[model samples]
Target: MDEAAVKEFIGTEISRSTVVVERSAIAFFASAVLDDDPVYTNADEASARGFEAIPAPPTFPFVMQNWGAFAELQAEGGQGAGLGMVLGPLMANGGLILHGEQAFVYHQPVLAGQTLTGVGVIKDAYVKESKGTTMTFVVAETTWSDASGAPVVTTTFNIIHRK
Candidate 1:
């Protein structure tokens, strides 16, 4: 892995996506994740729990890019330039990329019927040697905000490339 080449992407914006949180999608995700919480499925229960609408699961923001309205945006190339634009060139010679870790910071509750805009940026990049293999780690952060531009969730994840 070319550490210097990968480092060039640090502090760069890699992806921007718009996701419309739907109630049906939230119900499906909650079911798939084995979360049988009524608040995730019943709007009345959610409201009684002090939420304005159905509340998404804690880690729901991570999958927002794969489902919801983001799916349509992805087809139309609305996912900005994508992560491939940053990692593709660095791995042209062939290397393995792996997901390392992920975390989320919630500033406010994410309801099922809100639209969010996510902006991703490369936070940092570095290289390390383990068992004689060179590994390059890249840290990326994405902040999802509501229509009024208030942050709902900020997700940080790590991607590792090895050759």
Candidate 2:
């Protein structure tokens, strides 16, 4: 689809997937963050501290939410203006900034053994011209909830498609 067609598809509900939080995944996340916090690493310490299981870091939800949503979109053959395209045009015209703004709200901390189902939708889209290049901005919002129906987190990411 062309840019306009893609924009028209904005606000369309896209995909949903369920992810089970495993102990190994949690440990991997902890290692990635270099977080020495006992709450995320020491299971015994976490339980002693009254946590049922290791509490995932705040940003950990992105691993399952953002990347998962992107994978879903790509699987559906959605066109994406990649980073290379953004940089190539910018380099030709001195430079340009493609800033991505993300905001999230956490209703509950993710814990191991819990299953989170993520639902995502395209929220908005528009285009702007700067320095002789057109930039299409798409905003998508995703909500994740645990199997018990408790809200886990919500995220919104702004993607810039440059031309």
Clashes of each: 0, 0
Model 2, 7-108: lDDT tens per residue?
665767665666767676677788888887777878898799888888887778777643333334333434333333323433464434455788889897
Model 2 misplaced stretches (Cα beyond 4 Å):
1-4, 65-99
Q: Which run of 10 residues does model 1 get worst, by summed lDDT?
A: 69-78
- Candidate 1 — which residues are off by over 4 angstroms? 70-77
Distance from true position, residue 92, model 2, in Å? Answer: 20
Among residues 3 or more apart in sequence or in different chains, the pairs in candidate 2 whose N, CA or C atoms overlap within 3 Å are: none
Determine which window of 10 residues in candidate 2 has minimal summed lDDT. Answer: 66-75
TM-scores of the candidates are 0.90, 0.74
Alpha-carbon lDDT of model 2: 0.68
What's the lDDT for all of these models?
0.86, 0.68
